[model samples]
Target: MSSERGETVAPDWPHPSLGNDLTPRVAAALAAAIDVPDFGTDVDATLAWAVATGADVATAPLAEAWQLLASTAFVDVGAARIIEPHLDALRILAEAQRDGVAADLSSLGADESSMWGVFAAEGSGMRLTARTSPGGWTISGTKPWCSLATSLTHALVTAWIDDDTRGLFAISLRGPDVVCHEGPWHARGLSQVVSAPIDLDGTRAVPVGGPGWYLSRRGFAEGGVSVAAAWWGAACALLVPLRHAARTERADQIALLHLGEVDAAMWSARASLMAAAEEFSHDGGDTLVASRVRTIVAHAAEQALRSSDHALGPAPLVGDAAHARRVADLGLYLRQHHGERDTARIGRDLVRGPASW
Candidate 1:
């Protein structure tokens, strides 16, 4: 999912010197509107800002698109949590259209006003299935980890197309047959975005792609790395106070040491992503490229969390609402990486043979 472009459009808040562009303007607007602690409270307003800004992932260069996601996450992980999926859903839809796997976009009602969520996480004992009907397709059963299910207008859900394969389908969340179940999601971190289960009873849906196509597409891996880019931004958000503390005159040697190590890790992670973006821009998506970069960025984010705790102590975590929320948000968000499991996967890839490097 690489787009050739003439200029770079960096987001405004995190890096103003990157210059003025449509993405920067969107970033600036998001920065001003999103309140870190109270994020996800007003889904409509936040999504409205996004729709108004017209940030289409297909149009931007991969590097710039990732930068925008990272910058938004730097503001608030909750905002990133909302925006990233919307952007990913858009890209997924676009990929389906370009590959000629889906029908006209209008059939899915993919207009300017829609905010989408990607509901693909499967829970034990909960199986969502899709079947062909006279009225196109219908999805039934429950989908777990549907974040903001009640708030979002539409979602790209993955359901078992058959016993052997899963297919991606687009469904309107506001349908009468859809039921958003509350409770059971009581995590302190990222609590604002309630990821509850939703049950669909013969709800009509449009197939985005055939069985196995969603996971098989190149955009799947590339879209994953973009999520890691947001993770890196959230890590940067956590270290803001620590970086400031290390610069003060009374800064202790221990603070400086922690800051130095964390800074080095973050710098290396940033460089890795930049290099990955360059390669992806030229060669498109590769599983090895995505795996390597995600592992590096996830480790860097873990370092930020550990160093921020050790260097800053509990003061900010206890008193500063924004900082405390960022810490908690990042801590939970990093779990998406799968930690050592991801590392082991990368190791297996390396053991097989050398990558394109």
Candidate 2:
């Protein structure tokens, strides 16, 4: 399903891809708010600040800020993209001490991500379902591998009703109708990521836009861009340490060249991302540009990780030091949400179309 604008429709949601205008003010605010971590605990605090500030800012700037914050905070912004629309709800539910509500929505978002998880069964997809009733539609289904399931206030769960009609429901995770089952699966790389399972039996859900919403929207492409932004930040973080090592000659000359190559890749990735961001904001949504950005960021991340390992040698793996932790975290973050899959998709797009596509 593609939009009139030629953007592919996300699996099951409405709204064009994540749209954003990157005003200078918003970008400056985001850059200023992203603080380098002094300790492990600081990562969470920085992430909280980014999420809180991201709501009011323009989408492009927020995306940029999120990338920067994730780099310093060592959180998986890729996973965050899957759950972000509901962050506002989570914040509200958390403020009200409505754990059930927060858990419910978070689960919904997680379910959506899981449907696209690296291990998703072939041909299986998730959707958000909604219908009109006196009260509202009744939503029921299972969402697997929901990342950050415990942090959302609502989820856009897709469902089918009667043949030929699909529905998207913005179901509250906290309400009585929703049920979430925490998972046993965990990853060492992105430990902070809360991917879990959620069950909605008879949750009352509201409609999002209208029927066939996912087929008409470009939100997922925008999400791809967001993920790209975060990966860029992680690459940037790796560059800083690599730069220091190069300057001090802590590593051999060959290692220095590797760092330089990684730095050049990072700059290239950033340039691609900025170009995509501009196109997304100005032309509505362009899957070609978004895919290119995704590919660039993923390659940059891989290069940065490899270079960091080369520059720091076994120190990052052996020591429990901050640098080692950051390096490990970057590895984990890069693996989130099938980064390889995204890169492949971008490659496919590049081969099939012109650079401007």
Winning candidate number (TM-score): 1
The ten-residue window of minimal lDDT in model 1 covers 1-10
- Regions of model 1 farther than 4 Å from truth: 1-41, 105-110
Residue range 119-217, candidate 2, lDDT tens digits: 111124543233457865776666666655565444555566545766545565666666665666565555555566676677776544456644345
* lDDT, model 2: 0.51
Please identify model 2 stretches exceeding 4 Å from their true place: 1-51, 58-132, 161-167, 337-357
Local distance difference test, each candidate: 0.77, 0.51
Clashing pairs in 1: none
Question: Per-residue alpha-carbon lDDT of model 1 for 1-357, expressed as tens digits?
Answer: 001100111132243111235365555655555433344445666676555543545466777777777766776677777787888887788778788896454665667788888999999999999999677889999999898887888899999988989999998888789998765888888886778999999988888878899988867788889889899877876556776788899899998898888878888888888888888877778898899999999999999889988998888778776677777888888888898898899889889999677
TM-score of 2: 0.69
